[model samples]
Target: MVSKVTTVAFQGIEAVPVDVQVHVGPGMVAFNVVGLPDKAVGESRERVRAALSASGLALPAKRVTVNLAPADLPKEGSHYDLPIALGVMAAIGAIPAEFLHGYAVLGELGLDGTLAPVAGVLPAAMGASALGKGLICPAASGSEAAWADRDMDILAPRSLIQLANHFKGTQVLSRPVAKLHGNAGPLPDLAEVKGQETARRALEIAAAGGHNLLMTGPPGSGKSMLASRLPSILPPLTPRELLEVSMIASLAGELAEGKLTDRRPFRAPHHSASMAALVGGGLKARPGEVSLA
Candidate 1:
């Protein structure tokens, strides 16, 4: 029989759906994973094998083949590990196939069967929610995913055993609460500057009207110091803007502790930055300073 599990593939900050198809049949004792998977994704078989064994499940001796469908989109990252393993479990009847049908799963698995946090959980959660599906992810990322939608279903399991137990009705998993990063302290006051009336006036005008101010001065002219205080005077991001910022940060893997902040993003690249570094696009097509800001 064949079993399928839904997951996602990240393209920039967007999450694209990917279907994992697992088949177990009577034949030679072999296991294989197919699809246009990158090196990290290709190695999931070993991680899945070790993780399942640690979870007290042994692989049946049969011809087992897994295919990440669409077969054209390049699959990357270790997040495919959990879905592939779950697909195998469902195919082998270790876990009920019904439970996985409504959820999209993404996470990495350790040799000990513990789930490891992976990047792009926030975006993945958003995508899953858009599709009207639930999400299964690492516990560490549950709080991050919770921010995607309050009413969205999320399963943040700590290990393969925990997930299996929850599906088996032996244990129940609770939804994670969303978290925010508290401000460290009050920002620097503009009043601290003793002089430079013209510069101060320009800074104030720029802040009020949402304009950029170019400061040209000699050494020790306090250009950097003046720029640092801009955030204090600027307005905070709106809810929609906040989500957009957080999504970019999520894809860049820069969201600290998975906490979203209200402060507006302020990015200042060095003078020597390349064209690609200024705008978004490079070898990996990653977001740059302009896009982040």
Candidate 2:
């Protein structure tokens, strides 16, 4: 029998749906994963094997094939671990196949059966909501996913066994609450400036009218200092803006403990930073300092 599970593949900040198909059947005993998986995704077979063994389940002594659908799309990240594992379990009748049909699942699995947090949970949650599906993510990312939609169903399990128990009706898992970062002390205030009255006026006008201000001065002339205090004078981010900012931060893996804050972002890059450092470019094309700001 072939069991299928829903998951996602990230392209930039967007979460594109991917189906995980697992088949356990009569053949030579081997495990294979196909469909344009990157190294991280290819290695999930071992993690899933060990995790299931730790959770008191084992793969059958038959041929097992896992295919990530849309064979042309390149899949990356460790987040596929959970869905692939769950797909295998459902194929072997360890969990009811229908149980996973309603959610978009993404998380990393430890060798000891624990679940590790993965990046892009917020965007994945939003994509799942758009599909009218719920989200199943690591417990550590539950707060971040909760921000997607209040009425959306979410299952934030700590480990493989915990999730299995919940599905079997032996345990009940509650939805995780959204969290906001606590005040990290006070922000710099422009009122404390001893001088630079002209620079301060320019900062205020920039803040009030939402205009860009360019500052140039000799070293230690309070250019950097005045720029640092600009966020303090600016208004707090609106709810919509806060969500947008948090989503960018989430993709960059900069959200501390999956908690978000309302303060406007303040980025200070070194003058000698490279173009890629400022604008973001890498194997995965992750967001850079400017994008985070």
Candidate 3:
């Protein structure tokens, strides 16, 4: 028998649909995740096995194949662990297939059946909302995903055990709430910084027009110190900007306490950093300090 559950493959902020199809066939025991899975997704096999064993379940003695459909897309990250495991559970009749539909799950499984948080939950939940689907996410991240579509149905289960309990009707998973801040932090005051009259003028212009300023001064110049103080005079992050920055930070796994960023980012990488790291479109195509800020 075959069981299917919906998940997502992330490319930047875009979430491509992934259909987790678990097929069990009579043969020598085998388990695998197919369809362009990256190192992280592929490693989920061992994690799922350990989690299932810890949860008092075992892979059936048969060829169990997990196919992440739309095979051409590149699948990355351990978020696929939950859907793959749930698919197998449904296929093995451990969980009812009826409860499997309409929910998109994203999480990483620990050896002891713990539900570890994974990146990209916010974007995945956004995609799930667009598709009129509910989200099943880790406890740590449900608040983060809750920022995308606050009213969307979401299940934030703390662990595999809890999730199983919820599925079996022993408990209920509650919807996560967005923790995005609507105000900026109490920034450092600007009155304490004494001198540099001309430099302060340039600083004001940079803040006003959002222009670039190259300060050429001696070693004792307050370049670093002055830059650190800009957050004080900067405007508060609106709700929209907070979500954008938070989404980026979320994908980078840098969100703290599920708190959204309220202050404008001020990233000043070392001047000696490599070009590939500074520019976003380099070989790695990663967001450099400019984009991160």
Clashes of 3: 0
Best candidate, TM-score: 2
TM-score of 2: 0.98
Query: Model 2 segments beyond 4 Å from truth?
Result: none
The per-residue C-alpha lDDT of model 2 at residue 89 equals 96
Would you list the C-alpha lDDT of every candidate in the order shown? 0.91, 0.95, 0.83
Over 85-199, each residue of candidate 2 has an lDDT whose tens digit, in order, gives 9999999999999999999999999999999999999999999999999999999999999999999999999999999999999999999999999979999999999888889
Model 2 clashing residue pairs (backbone): none
- Give the per-residue lDDT of model 3 (tens digit) for 1-293: 99999999877767788999999999889898899888888989999999999999998889999999999887878899999989999999999987879888889998998888888788788889999999998898888888888679899887788988998988987787778555545656566789877777778888888788787777668887788777777787798887777766777677765557678887879879887657655422346666678
lDDT per residue as tens, model 1, 131-184: 999999999888889999999999999999999999999999999888888878
| RMSD after Cα superposition, model 2 | 0.9
Residue 97's lDDT within candidate 1 is 95
Query: Which 10-residue span in candidate 3 carries the lowest summed lDDT?
Result: 279-288
lDDT of 1 at 57: 98
